[model samples]
Target: MEEKKSNGLAIASLVLGILSIVIFIFLSFIGLSWIGLILGIVGIVLSVMAKKKNPTGMATAGLVLSIIGTVLCAMALIACIACVGALGQTAETTRDILTTIY
Candidate 1:
């Protein structure tokens, strides 16, 4: 009887995908979303290759999770940037108002 070997890339993709999501959820706000985003992208590429070589549940999960993590990380990063920009603008406006009143 021949046994089928599981794909390693698929496993790595799954782990990386999960890690990406965890990082996004826990550490995304501290300018660390890039790590998760990169991991997700790499996982996605690995998962696609793994699917072509040996399609499995792990590969599918990895692909889906990687996509989701990537999107969330991107969104978080954009939100953080926008928030910073807004804070800066608000600070400048407040300073201007205070200066004018004094």
Candidate 2:
């Protein structure tokens, strides 16, 4: 009798990929770009594993979503870093004011 392996990895990949996309969207709206970047990396790993294990349509979908999430996250991170750099170049008094606000 042939044995059937559980599709657990594929399912997990799908779920994580979807969650990554959702997180990316939410982060974009709230300006929490770092979280999105982390999630996107996780999603890409899961999706790639899923594809290697199962090669199903769902896995392909997950892969695509993960790639999109990664790109968006990267862009967000770059924008955030640029903003921080610009802020750093501002007056020393502005830094003191921000430190106090935080």
Clashing pairs in 2: none
lDDT of each: 0.84, 0.66
Cα displacement (Å) at residue 16, model 1: 0.6
lDDT of 2 at 49: 73
Where does candidate 2 stray beyond 4 Å?
1-6, 80-102
Compose the digit string of candidate 2's lDDT tens values, residues 1-102: 111121555556666666667777776777776676676677678767767766777767767777777787777667332255445556776677678766
In model 1, what are the clashing residue pairs, if there are any? none
lDDT of 1 by residue, 13-82 (tens): 8998999999999998687999999999999998898888888898899899999999998888764323
As a whole number from 0 to 100, the lDDT of residue 5 in candidate 2 is 29
Best by lDDT: 1
Clashes of 1: 0
In order of appearance, the predictions have TM-scores of: 0.70, 0.62
Model 2's TM-score against the true structure: 0.62
